[model samples]
Target: MTARALQRMIHVGCRELGLDADTRRDLQLVATGKASMAEMSEAELAKLLEALKARGFKPGFKPGVEPGAKGRRPAAPRPDLRYIHVLWGLLGKAGALKKPGRDGLNAFLRTRFEGKWGSVPIDIDALRDAGQINDVTRALKDMCRRAGVDT
Candidate 1:
């Protein structure tokens, strides 16, 4: 692997393990024969990777996935807002929602998915970053199904 990729793996591993500065420094010295990872040669970078592996560090490890995980990452849960809009329209027509527009949609989501949708703000941009999109979408689908509407 390239030195840059190896460096990134090391940094990620360090952050994951919460390694202290002295431990990082010691790793740097052992890996590169230098005090900095930035200056390490390709061979040294390989050594560093090996050292990290020996310490049980799995490169590219991600939260919620088992170590040595293979295959595709889990798909994000969020659905497009358009799908939400269509589902909301159906709910509104079914007399399930009292408010109109996005405000009404937020109210519906809050009521339907209390804990998951509680933290998501009403604004579109904010909702995009809220990381609760998938839950909201699932709730919307459930609402649609309950109202006898196909999503």
Candidate 2:
């Protein structure tokens, strides 16, 4: 697969639709045929995301067993626990977020991130990964709720 294609899709489309990891993985499995795509109904697929989003997740297609998910790739270390704390730091300070315009989130990222995260997708994914910071979805949602940010 092309990184250009992936990057373009991530920025131009996937980000806007908000597909979440499992949903993205399911779709990719269907696209790549690793998993049977026939059995699941649209409702079933949407439920996985809907359930999470209902609890405040900023759902998006994650496309594979993410850093945190069932049936994940082995020995990925389950991501960093403190990353959640960093996100909580951002959300805790969300009230102090700059202007609520088109770039509000981007501005937040600029102020919050440094070095490598000064780029797109990198910073965006860091924020997105916050939803999956905890092993359990409820924990993720609780974090989102704490910052008044939709998970």
Candidate 3:
């Protein structure tokens, strides 16, 4: 793979593992070609994933795992997404933003999202940097369905 492609892959992998802020920032630098992914050792990557697993952030296939003709189909309709319906709907209303607006989303998130997670959000740029906006959209739809939202 091209170095750029590999860097992108590494970026996605790091995010999937719920990396801490500093590590995620460093990886993002590498991903954007400002730094080098080769600087990190394979051992470091393995250890990071181990820690993620311990935190209940196990990485698996896309949420929907379909069977062949004889078995049950995958439950998810849009398995490629990230985040969830609330974010999806909120962000959708603010489409085509190059970066999330400073005030708009924050206000909604603070109010509507407060008690749901019992905390504020972390860097939203993490999701934007994934470069899979459509997949994230699809994933949110599937999430809504799975959550029994009458989708």
Output the number of the TM-score-best candidate: 1
Instruction: Estimate TM-scores for all models.
Output: 0.46, 0.20, 0.25
lDDT per residue, candidate 3, 23-141, as tens digits? 76554454343334455455444444444445444354432343333343233233332233345544445453233444444454456445754655453233342334454455445
- Residue-pair clashes per prediction, in order, are 1, 10, 1
The lDDT for every candidate, in the order shown, is: 0.71, 0.45, 0.46
Rank by lDDT (best first): 1, 3, 2
TM-score of 3: 0.25
Candidate 1 global lDDT: 0.71
Candidate 3 least-lDDT 10 residues: 73-82
Error of 1 at 118 (Å): 33
**Which sequence of candidate numbers ranks them by TM-score, best first?**
1, 3, 2
Candidate with better TM-score, 1 vs 2 = 1
* Residues 66-89, model 1: lDDT tens digits: 877674633324556666667777
Please state the error at residue 3 of candidate 1 in Å.
1.4
